[model samples]
Target: MKGFKFAGIHAGIKKNDQKDLGLIYCEKPSVAAALFTRNKVIAAPVILGKEKIKIGVCRAVLANSGNANCFTGNQGIEDARACSKMVADCLDIEEDHVLVSSTGVIGANLPMDKFKTGVPDVVQQLSEDNVDQFADAILTTDTCRKIVNRSATIDNKKFSIMGIAKGSGMIRPDMATMLAYICTDIHISADDLNKCLSAANEKSFNRITVDGDTSTNDTLMAMASGTSEAQINDAGSKKIFQDMLDDVCFELAKMVVKDGEGATKLAQIIIKGAQTKKDAFKAAEAIAHSNLVKTAIYGEDPNWGRITAAVGRSGAHVVPEKIDLYFDDQALVLKGDWQGTEAEKKTSQIMKNSEITITLDLNLGQETDSFLFCDFSENYVKINADYRS
Candidate 1:
């Protein structure tokens, strides 16, 4: 967390009068890596960020909510660049060193006047303790902050990693959802940092789904300040750092799913014994993304049939009679056979919890994969129905 200062301020971008602008300033030009949305129609900030991150260095990050600078064509890119330049001017840093991101209502223009004045104001308010404000500023429908911190000892030296993210809808795999920024005090190479981030993201952000819809403004990035002498060079040091990074990303990813728009319960979908990792992912994601299964979860119904049906159409290699299913530890189906009324009763009780795990065994091979999802509810429909209003 050293060398990183944060700030968030109300910039009039959001009509509701909440803090809509966030900034993170690193004292030094830190090594950086990033990932952006795979959506064909990318956002303006994402387009600029994809280029800026290629410099493999960053000094500041400017983000805003309530206006996704997307589909504005050339004007959006110009606006994003103009905002980046504004922040760079205030911080006395290169415009290229300031990576930008925007979220919330898409296909609309950013309130340039807000950035015209808010830029200098937020820069003036920068503080090392304003992470909470920054976290709050980036949230849309998220009910709370998705921030996580972890520490590791590398080469007898201690290092810290902090992650912050905001995503409550338009969530699915590929490049994942919304925006995430990671800061670490450990020394690392750009290549290694990218590797760690991509690997960790695969098992975390890329493994979660809320509505099975990807966003146009998705971005994930990491910055290493090197203020701490702890470095990652060898395999052992890299592994330790990788583990901590995974923990931080996964925790944030789970928070996004749990705080999903109008979600009341979080579910873990596990698919095992597949012939390949692709097959495993297909099965797990299919179940997680299935509206029928999600609604069943929300209703606290032990409808094991919905889960099996999802897998059947998942395009994964599966044998009809070889499947087994369970809700938590309660087995509802054994070798594709109903375990009986007692099992359904037990599973129904389990589903009533705020969090539950659904496991399906393909009994095929060794591959396995899992996904985090939230139950589909009436409130979810209502929230999205009026999201723009």
Candidate 2:
């Protein structure tokens, strides 16, 4: 809340001459936690952030776009280290007290000269009013800025959490879909902060998909400044802060789905009455990632066969005769039997909306899970194919 400074600057690393650098500074050592992509081929910044966060307290974060610094092996690691060290030197903090993140073309080397010129300017421009710039500077294909904030009270104390994220492609569950940075003034231990962040990611960032591709540079960072002086060690305060944080992250996650590159519709796929939570996820993800299903949604075609086929192959122990399906509020299938043409017409209308909800009830057990996804479009293919050009 107080004494927080953030800055964003154009570092000339991107080919388009966009602002590709950002930094966040907290006056005091803040409790810090981070989650990186589960992809085995990780980026350079992820490797460095993982080690820096082990110190349990962080005073600054440095991020860059346009080059992922991945696939270069040992050189990538050295670049990450050197960048963080540069930021530390400018801020007069320990090298381990600063974290770094990068997103862009994978397997390319970073231009260290960009860091030499940008880190010092970032340090000089740090201010409380530039949080939005930091949020916008980290984007790749994002169409608009994504940010969400919330405030809550536990006992007589109040706290606030604000988060910014960017992801329009290369999104899948394994961890965060893309980059997310969350900051709060709540007082919580680094251990507790990590715990809450993991729990929240499971139900939020980990449950979304776009193109079913996981990135090598996904990173989620949360910093708790303890500025509110409200100790979250107690159960009540912990619950309040965790709920607030989860809500903020969930909002950002949904925003990612809605902004999926060239996406025409945002979809909520719910699989219910499965034998287990894992089964539900299997069914949901299978449908969400299917090119046929996504293309159908894009065309506004209520094709039930594609949906059923996805469920059958999901390995969810689905019994075709016992399943029920709905597109939005339109019931297309009853007890696995297709309704008449009238119902099909109504469901087609439902699929045409900007936001659509599809439900599949297995009629097996009470277990249920949902995944958020976006419809595939021609623009998505064009954007990725010509990304570098």
- Write down the TM-score of every candidate: 0.99, 0.98
lDDT (Cα atoms) of all candidates against the true structure = 0.94, 0.90
Q: Model 1, which residues run further than 4 Å from truth?
A: none
lDDT of 2 at 119: 90
lDDT by residue for model 1 over 169-248, one digit each (tens)?
Answer: 99999786699999999999999999999999998999999999999999999999999999988999999999999999
Q: Which residue pairs collide, candidate 1?
A: none
* Model 2 clashing residue pairs (backbone): none
Worst 10 residues of 1 by lDDT: 168-177
Q: Highest TM-score: which candidate?
A: 1
lDDT of 2 by residue, 67-135 (tens): 889897899999899988998899888888899989889878999998899899889989989988887
Q: Against the hidden true structure, what lDDT does model 1 obtain? A: 0.94
Count backbone overlaps in model 2: 0
